[model samples]
Target: MLNAFRARFWDLALGSAMTVLFALSGTAVALPLAVAQLLPLFWRRRFPAAALLIVGSATAAHTVLGMARAIGFFPATIALYTAATHGSPRVKWVLCPAVGVAMAAASAVRHGPVEGLLMAIVTVTVAWLAGMERSEHLRQRMERAAAEDRERLARRVHDSLARTVTVMLLQTEALRATTPLDSAAEQRIDTVLGAGRSALAEVREALAAAGSGPALGPRLEMLRGAGLRISGHPPARLPAPLQDITDRLITEAATNALRHDGPGTLLTITTVPGDGTLTVRLTTEPGGSASGSQRAGGGFGLVSLTADIHGYGGELTFGSRHPAGWQLEATFPALVPGHD
Candidate 1:
């Protein structure tokens, strides 16, 4: 409501100021001609083409009267600018040139033909160009803002939900291998794995649409390279976001294990998928040269990861395990709402 009032105030102010200027100009037809040209300023933005026509017609009348001064000049220029900025392309192209011709003809009657025509054409051209430049700048600014927002969302998705998904895939694969199951049970596990892969693909597509940089790639391999022995095979593909989260979790666990318990620490990761939820556990056992306590501080990475997990209705916990190890566990929805 306040914005509407502010806009109306400016429109009335411009029109009234122009009207008063012409009234005090001491020309015979100045007051009436200025009123006709400037009155449309109130609706110039809302009905640009019509406003331009009204202002242009008054300008033409001012020219025909052979007034020594062009009282309609300022109002006509403002109307032309509004048309170029807000009017439809067809209306803008058609009306703008017509207004320019009228102004040039008026100027020619008042001054020398060549000088007046060039001056009026230059003035009209400048106003139109200014409006076009402003429109382009606004468009570019909006695009930049949208791109930034997409990038931020992509990062959050990758860090939290994607990591959780990766752990689920790894654990499911492990469960298939170590435990003998009936054919029906095996098929169900395969379906779950397939769904995990599909979810990952969707995350990749979303990141691509957002124009984020390169994929994180093969988190399982990354963990193995960090000297953690792998007991289970990951699915053929994992979603980019989940893969990133899994990588961070595994990396942080491995680092803490090696740092606190010396090199050659054993790390175990497991996943259990229930009715509508999935649980992941990462345990670290001290190496031969173990020294410090297993209670590691929750760093910024874990804090951020915790927030991300909670955002999707998940829970996370990490601490010293028994008398000999450290463990981190998280449980979250198997499929986040609205994601499928």
Candidate 2:
């Protein structure tokens, strides 16, 4: 019950001060008059500035009021100063000194000099603090916005580089088996293949080094849910985020296999985790040579794979057996290997 009254009184006091500050922006009145006029604002409002202004105004006005009571002029001013702070701008900084002097002059015929100076000093200090706090709030909001942009950029890099390179490695391997006897063409293919592998390696390193932070766990769960045909023993000890990255890569490789081959075709996937890296082996059976129809129906999965693996500094390679299946192989730095 007492809390409620305290709240109500603060509101009234604050509101009264703000109303007077806003209303009394013109020519200077005596500080004592301003305080007496604005003091009621505290009872009706909760703002700190309004409360501060009221107290400062009251202090300045007290001198004017005391003198009038001693002399034979107007009634003595009753200045009530309260303590509080608020979110809004302070009006008392401008009002207190100006009003204090004017009101003092009016009361000079009655009240004396000493008290007016003290009131002027207190009003200005409270107003300064309110302004500084407001600026800090604005600065914090801007920093939050900048951090969001960096996260978006990181997601984009994941989609483009790692995913693409993996699919391309698959396509190159398919071509390796069917190509005719042309020595120059094979050399050119080797050069292109070497460059592609190098690009894949660089991208994977970046991804591995970045270390996923908060995003690692969710990404792993998503890949595990995807339709990946797993045959080997499930890993018993893998860092959650790194395990997730590998799972996602496997899921994406499975997607490419389905995109290229009919559902009935067999796909074998193997993962070899070593001292500081992991090797992925995927073999998909083709009913025939990867033909014009297959090439025309290009898969952009490679682009996605490239982006994902690039950040981890991984490498991917492809080859095909004459008997009809294609192979996709990739190596990743074992589980964000750098940080450990």
Candidate 3:
């Protein structure tokens, strides 16, 4: 209660301070009107044009005032527009002041006709800059994220693919070295060859999908389609957070289910979203013995999951089920619009 009050108080205090500062130092306009241009930044992305209009309307008001006052803020507007668009650190200040003066003179000459044109120009410039910045930022971020994903995939290939291929090659060598009429060895070779070829195909697909994003839906679907009817729990959908943290966990979980339990094991990821948090539960039956460097060492995917969740200001936990089975669980705070 105290912390919440403190937070609210700080919010009020900051807002009030900003309001006072803008009123005193700004064009002596009210808070809502003067700072109105920035309202678009807080709007939902789906309503982009509306957001642009809001910012532009505010810009129009500001530009008109600055023109009448002969105060040079047109360059600042251009800079704001540019910063918001190209998101570049430095905006060309060259013509902004000149533009402002000209706009003011034009406004006077036309008795407010040019005011609309100047406002439109400023609005368009800011909108274009914001959009360009967003696009470039998203593209760069996706590229980095894709690169990380591919790196993780390359590791998986190095681990599982190399091991599977080696087994295949060794099995082939053993089969060749077997004497004539080696029925048992011949049958083993058939199994090994089949497994190897399947593994090779899977590896190739993984490599292809590395830099690319995952196919939609559950990871187990990939395993089940590959002829592993391994089951320990039930059907599971990934948490939204895990959607951003796939590859390693997906591979590890599937590997454990397939290798540890062989086949016919049920695995389920249970999700419970409530009370400003999202909970994830992964349950595996008797076959839930966790493998991999971290899990095998009794180190925590739960801990990591918790850290990840808490990074978003949430929590996570893991434990044995009531009656039986091993369970992994995570809880994350759901993002609330305009709450930030």
Candidate 4:
């Protein structure tokens, strides 16, 4: 609404009326310069710096002529505000003061030094301050709106994509067990499954980057119900990255365990904090079927999990435990409060 009143044609019409009023008030001697000063108000919003320069030049011309100094002040004030509010930081900090000082010197030369300089200083200062305040308020409001948008997007990823990936994992595991497959078919299945799982982990990591994500507890429970027998009590407060990394580690370890072993296999998940390091360990019974499984590479999810852990100065080690099972252990440094 305010901008509409300051629109190009509207400003021109208003300026014309102001010019006619000044002429009627017996200040018509500087009519041409005053008119030139006010005319550029038409493009104040689109080209604030140029408008300020034009208006400032005209104001200086009329003030030096000692004919219509007051007539130009109104348009010059409006142009100053436009420059401060819409100009880039360099223009706002530098060009605005330069234009104001030039106009102030003209005003001081025309009127008495005390009154003319004070009027010029106060008018330009107040207008610039008002414009700067408004700019800062608008900037803060936009930042808040952007943060809310990111959180909303994170929630959507959690509710929709996370669940879809969970279902995909369960379906893939079940299909691998029931269906008989040749070597090529088994390799193809592993490739598809690993790709899907890696994509899901990447999505989770991205959402967590925005400081919002699904909790680890619910995801752990879902995995437990799917196939693997899991047991662990995670801490109440963990960094979002660590929680996400741990969740991926558990999912990948469980998937690999279920793929290799029979239904009787027991997978144990444990979280332990000691000596400034939080460790998550997954143990599974090893030595299952090798008929069509165990291709060239192991699980691709392991590679993804290793990168995630290493990013936080953590380490992940996996190999056969003492007598019967495989153990995958990830150790992360405990983060101080407010650091994460």
Superior candidate under TM-score, 2 versus 4: 4
Candidate 2 lDDT (Cα, whole model)? 0.47
- Give per-model TM-scores: 0.56, 0.30, 0.43, 0.55
Q: Write the per-residue lDDT of candidate 4 for residues 287-318, one digit (tens) a residue.
A: 34422133334467888788767766678988
Worst 10 residues of 1 by lDDT: 233-242
For candidate 2, write residues 1-340 as lDDT tens digits: 3545666665566455455443454312354464454444433223333443454345335444452222111111212122111121223234333443554454443333444333323433333444344334433443343345445655677688777887887788779778784898889888878988998897766666544433434433444454333334323344443454555555555556555564444457677754235677777654344431133322466566655566555776665545565666777653221211
lDDT-wise, the better of 2 and 3 is 3
TM-score of 3: 0.43
**Over 4 Å off, model 1:** 1-5, 27-32, 67-71, 159-161, 177-180, 211-340
lDDT of 3 by residue, 1-340 (tens): 3544554565456445544555555553444655654434433122333443454455445555552222223323433433333221212132223333444444444345455456544644564456456545544554565578567868878787678797777768675677564788778777777888787777777777666456534666777775444433432343333455433343445555555554554566555644223455666554334231223322454355455555544455555555544455555433311222
| Best candidate (score: lDDT) | 4
Question: What is the overall TM-score of model 2 with all chains considered together?
Answer: 0.30
Residue 100, model 4, lDDT: 86
Give the alpha carbon lDDT tens digit for every residue of 1-340 in model 1. 3544676788889888887776677443655776678788888765677888888788767766765345547788888877776554555567788887888887777766776777778888888877666545544554455467569888999998788889999999999999999999999999999999999888878777665322323544554576545443221122334344555566666666666765566778787644334567788776565653756568787888788667545788998877687888887643232211
Candidate 2, 293: how far from true, in Å?
A: 7.9
* Comparison by TM-score, 1 against 4, better one: 1
Winner on lDDT between 2 and 4 is: 4
